[model samples]
Target: MMNRLKAALAASAVMLAPVFAAPALAETELIFNSYLPPHDELYQIAIRDFAAAIEKESAGGIKVTIPDTSLAPSDRQYEMVRDGIADMAIVSTGGVPQLVTLNKIGDLPFNSPSARAASIALWETYNTYFLPFDEFKGVKVLSTNVLPGRQILSVGKLQAKTVADLKGAKLWSPPGALSEAVKKLGAVPVNSEFTDLQEYVTKGTVDAMVMAPNSAKGARVLEYVTGMTQIPGGLGSLSFAVFISQERWDALSPEEQQAIQRAADGLPARTGAAADEVLAKLAPEMAKVPTENLEGAQLDEFTTLLQARIDEWKERAAKKGLSDPDEVLTFYRDVLAREAKASGS
Candidate 1:
């Protein structure tokens, strides 16, 4: 009887041992910071999809979450993420030129008829030329993109049908090539960030601005801009990049890294399309905005002025060790041409 009882106890112990020894797998959490307003549905979708892909690729070993609001101001996001205040971020390269001028290839006023084409072309350029650079040493870049090529916009009706009309005009200008373009065109540029422009627009303090139409729409300031000049090759474009802290990215398992990269592959085109969709949706309304159609000599002169900016960028690129900036610029434009045709842009 005692032997039988002991045997039964031993059998129960053996049956429970496996269950007691097994442990639940821990999930690695990544926090994503969204500095821009949540108006960009496509970008938001890409981020969400990227999160899902990461989870799927890692087989649920990793999880990501985006809070309802930003973790920091738009200007400070690069620093925030670099410092590991947040694990991931998508920030405009223009805001952190000191940290990432190479990615500014997207900002070079290198215009495209389609933002999608521009974005993809720039992404490819980044991988080919800028990816190996040490500027992003503390960050792991996921993707780079250009906003919809910026068009010249003004509040109220204007006869800005010619570059001469812009002479002596005070304009809100983003820092960098756009600001330089405005200056070269004889406009007084009030250098400022996007956040500062709304206040000026609301008060009619500035005469005009060069910005992506979708950005104006996203910020709900479209109603304020009543004049426009559409440029297929924008005078300037905003560049942006998405990234994770190098420490955090390195901490991820090798499999997780591969999975995350695979997921990141979709961001550039998605962000570009989001800008286009917003612009397209507001097209009818924008059409109502009085436009200055620069023609003949005016068009040539305006383009000539913008062309100088390209030379400036090439000089800067050479300084950055591109060896031959013209070759790289040509490659970028060629890619844009091919991609534009493929996407029917």
Candidate 2:
């Protein structure tokens, strides 16, 4: 999972020789690293489309080029950008916990019903509360989006309607808080990137997974099991931030910087919408997989077990220098609810 290309470190600004076409194309060229697969719509809208928009907004004064392959692995993206191996890319907050603890507070279970709203809410919360702390000190954050909540999928059945059903079960969990949540609830956790989930499930290394419903299709794990229990928001979620090396952002002319910011506006919603679209497309098939609706006492019980997640999160947030972390969490939820209602999503 750590496999990364050794690309030459780039300078703060990679202004390339302008094309000799009838109209001069660019004075500034930014290398936007592509990490996820071609089918990933977030990359399409946030990276590729944003690049084109910035070029137009700047009247071709800025150009962004994507390499055929990524300069670094997904987990290595932020480090690469901060060290100047790439100009811009989306960094995963959950994947790099130490560098981005505060952002994960907004990812508590049952966060938002709509990806677009959750994403917009997450960014608003970040800009207001976390920015002054410089959580991501070396890179210039453009925008952020949290992925849709993951379903609690068991291998071949939906027996997870009760906490007892999960006891001693080997469940694949995203590392950090989610893993802690799984353990606190009595399930044995197998920690790894969801990209490798298929191998584990197929090899019988784990009996269940906490992941986005679309991963059943994307990771080719749809045929393996039939049980599904979606946790509101997500069982846990990953947050992504589009960022450019601070040096690169600082090097841009005032006009060029504004052009890029204009193009970056609403990126969180745009990426979140793309993610929702993919989830909606696969939802029907997911519905066919036997699911147990969580309600009544069962829901209450589950929530009780999840108190540890909240308690643990608050401690982490306070330790990170955030005052009144609980208020911050409430602020995120209020914003999410309002945005979701306004958008009718």
Candidate 3:
């Protein structure tokens, strides 16, 4: 069934192929490495849907080979591209903080309302302020994308009613800004991947966890996480940097580059769509379990607390020689507002 689905997807891609202004004779092959498993929809769509578009747009001259692996995780994907271990890979900067501080702006709590707004702002930031090429010496970024925001998940009884309620709780979180946020909430932050969530929750090693609405479904952790709070409006919005080895990027013909860029145009939109789809698809089942939607003053307090963290991030950025921090932040805010207004957010 999966193969048939992939085949059908590939056919659709070829049908929507774009015609280039000028045709070239040279052909190129690029390896597209991902940390996601094959069964995951995001990985499949990227490999099958996006790759098909590339092949079609290049008129069959440019081929992208996607290898499925969890061994080379997202944190290592940047290094893989930098050192040429892999030609190209998708990475989340939030996974490694010290090395990529600038990228964390996308992960600031409550700065963005949804993945679409965040993704658009992220592209603008990367292009205008934090140019990926300038920051990472040996690789070129082909695309940037945003994931959905994280939610606070707990077992048996809910404890995240007030900021004070989070005190003394053992909470599991991925490494990066969110971990820091957990610390602020007075929860002990345990560094664990989403895959470990169910085990940790079931065994009482972790009383709560921060996860994307979709990730619980992908990792099958929803079975253990019965309560969820919308405490992280922007914490889930991670900017994914897709890098191609400079050597590989340089080797490609101009035609291939054009084809690749054309293929990458709507990556942010697609990623955001995937996130929304996950929420919409999962909401029904999630409703079967007990869930309370936080809004009004409660939601406002969460956003305010999260915004304080954003201020700290800006100060950190300034210390790192990103002069005009306010300008960069203002630009981000403005972009968010513009996109939100356009989308009726």
Residue 260 lDDT in candidate 3: 80
Q: Count the backbone clashes (under 3 Å) in each candidate.
A: 0, 2, 3
Candidate 3, position 186, lDDT: 71
For candidate 3, report its TM-score. Answer: 0.85
The digit string of per-residue lDDT tens for model 2 on 233-315 reads: 66667678888999999999999999999999889999889889998898778778888778788777888888778887889
TM-score of each: 0.87, 0.90, 0.85
Off by over 4 Å in 2: 1-21, 193-195
lDDT ranking, high to low: 2, 1, 3
Best by lDDT: 2
Q: Rank the candidates by TM-score, best first.
A: 2, 1, 3
RMSD of 1: 4.0
lDDT of 2 at 273: 91
How does residue 168 of candidate 1 score in lDDT? 86
Show model 1 residue runs off by greater than 4 Å: 1-26, 191-196
Q: How much is the lDDT of residue 231 in candidate 2? A: 62
lDDT of 3 by residue, 143-251 (tens): 6666677778886565587777778888788877778888876778898766777788778888777777677777677787778777535444556776688888788
Q: Which ten residues in a row have the lowest lDDT in candidate 1?
A: 37-46
lDDT of 1 by residue, 1-345 (tens): 999999999999999999999865647899988865555664465566667777778787887878788889988888998888899888877778776766776776646556778888888988887787767768888887787777788875455677888898887778776788888788888876666778888887888778867777755677898788766667788877788999998898888899888888767888778767777888898788887666678788788877787788888777877788888888888988998778776
